[model samples]
Target: MTESLTIVRDDLTGAATRGLIAAHLAGMLANTPVESVHALDLTELQHPSVRVYSAWVGGEIAAVGAFKTFDTDRAELKSMRVADAFLGRGWGRAMLGHLEREARDAGIRSLWLETGSGPDFVAARRLYESAGFSYCPPFGDYSLDPLSVFMTRDLDPASESAGR
Candidate 1:
């Protein structure tokens, strides 16, 4: 935590970023059913609607996070992962706040995310909850599933209480 983190928009071509994303996908597939694994692949992360960012502590990639826009008002948080070496260092919360600022600055009004519903995801669930992301029914292209947990938060300051 002593090192400063610099978060930048990523092109997704760097090996560190790709490796972390691969790990994120592997974790998802290993923890959840294939049908309930909603994490985006490399190709999907490069889509025009998706924007990925990487947080670095000097030469080391601390974490990676992304969001996929659904029109102008809403977006889905995607691909958030802290490198194994950076775990327990508050990188997850830092990346989450960074992505929230990016989305809000770009005029996104609400943010949604789908994460695993299991023991492997307890920490993730806690992070989202602490950030005011309340549980919600599946949104967008998602459907109800036992292994999936959907949560959302409103970006507008006036509706912040409602989001919680």
Candidate 2:
């Protein structure tokens, strides 16, 4: 907990970033059915609508989180993973909060995410809920499935009221 951490927007095409993403994808797939694994890969992360980030401590990657735009008012959290050694130390929470702030500043009023709904994902589910994300219908191209859980949170109270 004493190590300094830096989470910033990153390009995922780099070798190290690719390695981190591969590890993340492995975890996601291993924890859920292949059809339900919606985690993005290197090619998918290159889309113009997506922004990737990496958290660093002691000059090594600590975690990675991504922001994917859904039109102008909505964004989806993608590729959220903390290095195994960094788990349970609040890096994931910090990265999620950072991405939420980035999305809000970019004018995204709604933030959504899709994660596995299995015991392996308990910690991730807890992190999202504790950060104010709540269960919601499947988003984007996703459909309801017992293996997947979708959650969302309104980023701006003012916008939520304005829409009403």
lDDT scores of the candidates, listed in order: 0.91, 0.86
Model 2, 1-164: lDDT tens digits are 68899887897756767889999999877777788889998989989999999999977899999989989999999999998888888888888878877888889988999888888889999988887789999888999899999999888734322111
Cα deviation of 43, candidate 1, in Å: 0.4
TM-score of each: 0.94, 0.92
Q: Looking at candidate 1, what is the lDDT of residue 125?
A: 98
Q: Write the per-residue lDDT of candidate 1 for residues 71-109, one digit (tens) a residue.
A: 987999999999999999888898898888889888899
Model 1: lDDT equals: 0.91
Off by over 4 Å in 2: 157-164
Clash count list over all predictions: 0, 0
Which segments of model 1 are wrong by more than 4 Å? Answer: 157-164
Q: Global CA lDDT of candidate 2, please? A: 0.86
